[model samples]
Target: MSKIIDLIKAKEEGSKPFISIEFFPPRTADGVKNLYARMDRMKESINPLFSDVTWGAGGSTAELTLDIAEQLSTTGHVANMHMTCTNLEKGGDPKAAVRGALETAKKNGINNIVALRGDPAAGQEEWKAADGGFTCALDLVEYMTENFGSEFGISVAGYPEGHPNAISEVEDPSSMSEAEKARSSMEGGKVYTCRDADYKKEMDYLKKKIDAGADFIITQMFFDTKVFGTFVKDCKTWGINCPVVPGLMCINAYAGFVKMTGFCKTRVPAELRAKMDSIKDDPDAVKAFGIEFGIQMCQDLTEIGVEVLHFYTLNLEKTTYGILKGLGYEVKGSAWARVGDQVKTANGVGVVKSIESDGSASIEFEGETPTATFKKEEYSKVF
Candidate 1:
């Protein structure tokens, strides 16, 4: 088993944040091929220490998720397999599905797992425990820890703003007064409904998960660094000491921004929303703004002692690379140029290399050279 805990601890001790990237299952063969090709391009620039592969709805892409995890593991990066209780059997029923998934991941050499209580399926009003499946994320974590031993580094989700399912109380009296009048002049009482998680409650939950054997906590994506800072403070105050890596998604297009925030229930700052809204009709301008905003956000986060910046690379290169460049980071091997080989440019010169169908590339630059092989898919941001 890989020493994910040690690596995390080392990062904590050194005061340097580690970086991880995430990718979802591809819907088509072409998409898969393109993602692999892009991964090759990004490898050198992003230099991610780990990568996460997400399971699809209802665990539809379980097998594919394992395959991708295994492939990423081969690149010398830790691959975290995502597992959800949405499809697992619970309540003393046969643990066939969960067992099989874990065994498959083990067979493929994936030692880390991120367990989630995934969103309900389409057309479903609410998520119900699967017949014989575990009831919640904590149950899944307990199972993995017991079954996989100490080799598995388990991760759970944290919501800085609060979980959408959590509820808060507010005063309303129009209907209350009539009900009170009929009930012998009873006093009014507030009702609780499903709402976002309260900040303090969220901190308590994180502490519980840590005590339950979660090695790390990866947060739902957010736009504001202040929110993350507050979350860190609350974690300390609540005595939850596990590593919390902030999730970041580089918004490259207005449509993508809308879709992602909607899916994650993340707040998009009004200033950013306005900027995106203004360029909704212009794809080029939107792309430029996305890169700039993402770069600035990254720089600010790093400056404020964020230990790691986890990027959701929706399998695109141009925007990701543009953000890296804007942040003054260069692609790994672009410094040395070779004779007769020229780097191409959409806006500026890039040490050029041809990408393959499988999404791998060997980049060779002109002039003086360094001893490194550049791949396109490895970078979240490349200069």
Candidate 2:
């Protein structure tokens, strides 16, 4: 099977835009079954350039993640497995399980991985480093490159606004209770944010990962296009050049949105937050707004020169389909399980801008400055 880096590179040959979707390993057998069916249907309909399966914190869902990844490969979908720096130690060797997982993926014909430092597992407030194991995603990237050479295509996570943990402390001199003042003086009540120095560290560390052989970056989700635009510019200023794919978090429910945004320390635009808060009580209304808002955000990203849009599908399809349909993509094919939509195109390849009533689509080619017309029969939708 082809690696994700190779596919991403393939997307540049013309003007076609691409998209990749991510799914987390489900906890139940039935959930897994449903996800497989959903993924199959999505592959046929949306034709995602590639799809990924997430590893649970501390490798809680390791075996199942591997199984699903293998299944994807067998079914001819290029699977990118997520591997975290947790639960990878045995007899004092930190790389035992990490190496095992990578080797297993290779044996299963999976050459793509998203190296992550992972969040804390269930009931844990902070991520604890495993003794003798890797400390962060940076270490994992370096280790993979050192051990595996060019055998695997690696992509690392980038926090466009800086990581949640990499924050600065602020001092407040406001009126406070005695205990509150004491706490403030100590490990205090000051809120953390990505300030100048912290953001510099984030940039520096990201460069290190790229230098360590990360082929591309997939950013943590952000609502503001300006933030993503600034990040792309700064990556150039920092001399870390590579394809930076935007991660889109599908707005599924009100409560889940609040919880995820709060946990990630993601900055929500005031208007968007208010929009969600207004419809917090009605599930259907909230979902409708999600699809509407998602359509707008995606259009903005595409206009801003974003190529491969990565959707955090959350293993659901309605919102994703709504957003794509709203963006003028002809959502087709069955809702039931099937496979075989793995055509990979190069970057900078012109995407079909318009589909005529008679089936001709406008596509930009290598020499064309303006998009030219092509028959729908002549060109394929690779995204």
Candidate 3:
């Protein structure tokens, strides 16, 4: 089994920043078929250093996730399966599911896993510990170390701006940084946030995870490089020195963007948010912006000498491929079709759609006639 942590540590001379991709198991049989096709296509062109499969909340997708991870590993890709603390029994004739899953992964030649305190199950507002199950991610890390003993390379999640769940609801916002203020959302007009003290405690907890023998950390996605830069600096100051891989969220569809940003309480810069809002009606424009923004964001991170560029691909190809190509990564051309490739855009939030000879696209955000034709660089595929 090829361990991801060992792969990252064993980089040879002149190696470019390591590239890793993430995918989630599909729910339907047809969706799984399509995913396999896409995965094969991605590997052929991008040749990622490794790939990850995500587990559903509360082990809902455990079987499918393990199946994909095993397939990826058996087919010669370093597959890191994600495991959560859900449904795990600590003692008293505990459920064998957790141990069984680990043994199953090992038996399938997959020796890497991302340990997590996964999100609560669907329809649950807050998470409660299961009877006889581990309480948090820390416990899970300890369990793996005790049970496996150097048999797996474990990766843990690090939130650069503290986990959203840990943010303080009653903190004084007056002394908060502008960036900190941006990381909040309004429910009934309360400015809940990740206060400084709370963030420090978070760092302390992160140290415990690393100190518990986690091999590396893959951070939660962030839009601001300063947040990540500060995180890396703080990680060093705290003496928790291990490779921290930035998890990059790929810009996919318009609806998905709003949903994720809102859910994560992610800090989107005013300018970037406004740009996204302006193009909310045009998916192609949003995708084009994603590639452009991803390229610049990646360049900024690379300048900080990050050892790896891990992408949260969200199971799409065009934007990820476009971003990599924009960054001068070797990528073959793909005939991947955009969602609006053949559709009558006459139905959605926009109007007149025209594709030019040079594959440039123009759209009228309101009227029946086009008003502005954006440059090719401003967007990805022509609508």
Q: Model 3 — which ten-residue stretch has the worst lDDT? A: 343-352
- Greater lDDT among 1 and 3 belongs to 3
Which pairs of residues collide in candidate 3? 288-380
Q: What is the full ranking by lDDT, best candidate first?
A: 3, 2, 1
TM for every model, in the order presented, reads: 0.78, 0.81, 0.84
What is candidate 1's lDDT per residue for 195-281, written digit by digit as tens?
323445666767877888899888887787776677777788888887788888878778788887665556555687678889899
Candidate with the larger TM-score of 2 and 3:
3
lDDT of 1 at 352: 40
For residues 290-371, write the lDDT of model 3, one tens digit per residue: 9999998999998877888989989878778878888888764232433244322333333325655443556455556435
**Global CA lDDT computed for model 1:** 0.67
Off by over 4 Å in 1: 12-16, 88-94, 167-197, 333-383
